[model samples]
Target: MQFRYLGRSGLKISEITYGNWLTHGSQVENDIATQCVRAALDAGITTFDTADAYANTKAETVLGDALAGERRESLEIFTKVYFPTGPAGPNDSGLSRKHILESINGSLTRLKTDYVDLYQAHRYDFETPLEETMQAFADVVRQGKALYIGVSEWTAEQLREAHALAVDLGVQLISNQPQYSMLWRVIEPEVVPTSKELGIGQIVWSPIAQGVLTGKYAPGQPLPEGSRATDEKGGADMISRFMNDRVLTAVQELKPVASDLGLSMAQLAVAWVLQNDNVSAAIIGASKPEQVHDNAGASGVKLDADVLKRIDEALGDLPESDASQTRSPQGRPS
Candidate 1:
């Protein structure tokens, strides 16, 4: 597996990394999660991304349990704060100093690690002052609870402000985690260029567009059984949005390109994202070990310039006119 320096930082992470969003604790059982993590590690994925709020804090526990013993030091662990993990009121969430301190400690205890390689703010906390948040992050770094800090789903202005604050406070903000995929190109106009200019790498999530680009869903077909979209609690809206004719047609049209290039639709979608120099890694979520193995193979496949152009043409121009419109959770332009 190929690796890249995370932004301008010396930390090198595998180009294809493993992420547990809704899979580890919510969907897959402990043994299944362990198998998936082991598969990813065997395939040379050294970075594992999770969030304290994922699965009500069970994800990190599962990950820690899976990585227990000999494999701990071989992996780089990244977890996020800034999300509510309980009903402790407003202070229980956001980037407040109280929350940051408590959340990091909670994550550390759950992960069974003294320090996290990367700690990220799950999203912008508009209610809190930027200095308060950055200073809290700096304090964590100083205390050795976190090595590098990042922000996720932040706008360009927010990212710049955070980076400036980190610089002034003498803390290095390493990367930004955002949803960026073939079907979701909103980040291209602002977030991508800003990250490139500011020397912050982007470890993008949903690189396969929540499996919309995987070609598993077809137009006018019943939802596949046991798919994430079929989950009773999750991905209902994702299924609806992706099952539309327009998205299905796009996926269908893109299939031959992937087939011709000797890759799965998921691999082609991931390779397309990794083609960007600003992207340090693509955080792939998998329900099964084989899914992680398939995505890991994407690290070696490079899309030619012509194929990229064709993809752009097929996907059409990015929806540049809708920057002000906030996207839905599925990464759809509003």
Candidate 2:
């Protein structure tokens, strides 16, 4: 796998990061999760991303256990806060000082590590004071609990404010993790440019548009059995927006593009996002080991200009690039 620096930091991470969001501890059993992790390691993926709120905080424990025997220095581990992870309490959520501090401790314990390579705010906490959140993140770095800081799905305005506060606090806000894909381009217009100017890199998730770009969900076919669409645990609903005929058909149009490039639909989708210089890595979630190996094929693949234009044409207007649609502060769990 190809490696790239995380933002302007000296640290480097695999271009394809193995992420366990809906799969680890929830969609897949722990033993299968271990196999997937091993597959990622075998494919030369050194970066792993998880969140404290994923699977009600069980994802961190499972990922920690899976990586327990690996050399700590050989991996880049990332996790996030800002979503409720435990029993519903007022302070059990958001970027409040109480939540950020306590959440880090909880995450470290569950991860079985003293520090994470990067700590991110899972969402923009509209409820908290920006200064309080920034200061708390600075304190995390000062305490060596996290080597660097990042934010997920923060709008350009929110990121600007937080970045200024981070600079004032003498801390490096190194990265931003957002939902980016062939179908979701919300970060392109504003977030990507702003992050590039501010020395922050974009570590994008859902490059496959929740499996829509994989070309597995055909226009008129039934939902793939045992796929995320048929997953009874809510993965189906998460991908419902792209289940329509128009989206599925548009995705089907890209099959030839993949064929011309000698890439699987998933590889083309992942590589499409990496074409942007600001994107440091694309996080891929998998249920099977083969998925990990298949996505790794996109690691160093380069898409020429004509292929990119064809992708845009094939996708038509189905992509969402509006900055407004982002930072919605919705009910998404990581």
Candidate 3:
């Protein structure tokens, strides 16, 4: 597996990071999730990403169990805060000092690790003072619960503000996790430039547009049984925006390009995201072990100028690049 330094930080992470977002403790059986993690390790992936909010905190436990015997020093495990977890109390979410502090402890306990390689704010907390959140993150670093700080789906301005605060607080803000793919180019216009200026790399999720770019959901066809589009366990909601015929029809155009490159549609999609220089890693999740092995092949695959242009032509204005789409919750979760 190819590894890249996250932003300007000294740490290097596998270009393909195994993430358990919708699968681990919710969609897939525990044994399958463990096998997927095992597959990732067998494919030379050393980075694993999860969140405390995933499956109401069960995802971390499953990942921890999956990674139980591995040498800790050889893996980069990351998790996040900023979503309503536990009982969904008044203070159960957001980046408030209490939540960030308590969440880290809970996350550490669930992950079966003393410290995460990087701890992230899952989303920007509009209700909490940025100072309070960054200060709490700095404290997380000082306490050695997390080695570095990061954020997810934060706007460029938010990143700028947080990076400044992180510097003032004497902590490193190294990465931003966002949904970035061939079909979801929302981060390219603004977030990428700002993160580059602030010395932050992107750990992009949904590099396949939640499987849309895999050419599986064809236009004029019924939604595949058990596919993410048919999943009611939050996956359907996340992948719904890209389910229209216009998008699906356009996605099918990339099949030949994948064939020409001797790549599968999924590999083409993942490689397309990694072509962006500022992207440190692309997070891939799986329901089965074979899926992990297939997607992992995208690592270290290079797409040249002509192939990139052909991809853009095939996608043709179907990609979403609006900077305004890079958003956080309007209010604190309750």
Candidate 4:
């Protein structure tokens, strides 16, 4: 596996991180989730990303069980806050001091670890003061609960403000986790530049656009059985944005590009995100062990200028690059 430094932090993470988001506790059975985690480890992946909000905190437990016997020092485990996980109480969510402190303790216990390599704000809390949030994160770092701090789906301005506060509080805001893929370019224009200037790396999610880039969904054909588009728990809604015929047709055009590179559609999609120098890793979720092995192959793959141009051409105007598209909840969750 290829590893990269997260942002400017000394910590190196596998470029292809195994993430349990829609799967693990929700879509896949516990046994299958454990098998997938083992498959990732076997494929040389040492980075694992999860969140307390996933499956109402069940994802963290499953991941903890899966990594129980692994050498703790060799793995970089990450989790997040800012979403209602427990009882969805007012104090159960957001980045308030109370929530951050309580959430970290709960997360550490659920992950079966003393400290997470990185702890991210799952989303920006408009209701909370940014200072309170950063201060709490600093405390988490100083207390040895999380080594570094990060935020997900935060805007460029939000990142700028948070990074400044993080610096003042003496915490390392090392990474930003966002949805970035061939079909989703929202981070390219604003977030990437701001993060680069702030010395933050991107841990991008949905590099395959929720499996749309896998070419499994045909332009005018029926939805693939058991595909993400058909997952009702949450996947179907997340992938719904790309389910239209125009997007599907554009996605299908990349099949030949993958063939030319001798890569499966999924591998191409994963590698495409890694092409960005600022992207330290691409988060890949899996329901099966083979899927982990397949996506892991994208670790060190390089896509040249020609291939990149072909990708853009195939995708056409289907990609979303507006800076406004990168946003968090306008109001507090729950």
Tens-digit lDDT track for model 1 on 247-290?
Answer: 77777888889989999999999999999899999999888999
Residue ranges of candidate 3 with Cα displaced over 4 Å: none
Cα-based lDDT at residue 179, candidate 2: 91
Prediction 2 TM-score vs. true: 0.97
Q: Order the candidates by lDDT, highest first — what do you get?
A: 3, 4, 2, 1
Residue 203 CA error for candidate 3 (Å)?
0.2
Q: Write model 2 residue lDDT over 228-318, tens digit each, in one string.
A: 8898788888898889999999999999999988999999999999999999999998998999999999999999999999999998899
lDDT of 1: 0.86
Error of 1 at 250 (Å): 1.5
Worst 10 residues of 4 by lDDT: 325-334
Clashing pairs in 2: none
Poorest 10 consecutive residues of model 2 by lDDT?
325-334
Model 1 TM-score is 0.94
**Model 3 Cα RMSD, Å?**
0.7
Tell me the lDDT of model 3 at 138.
Answer: 98
Per-model lDDT = 0.86, 0.92, 0.95, 0.95
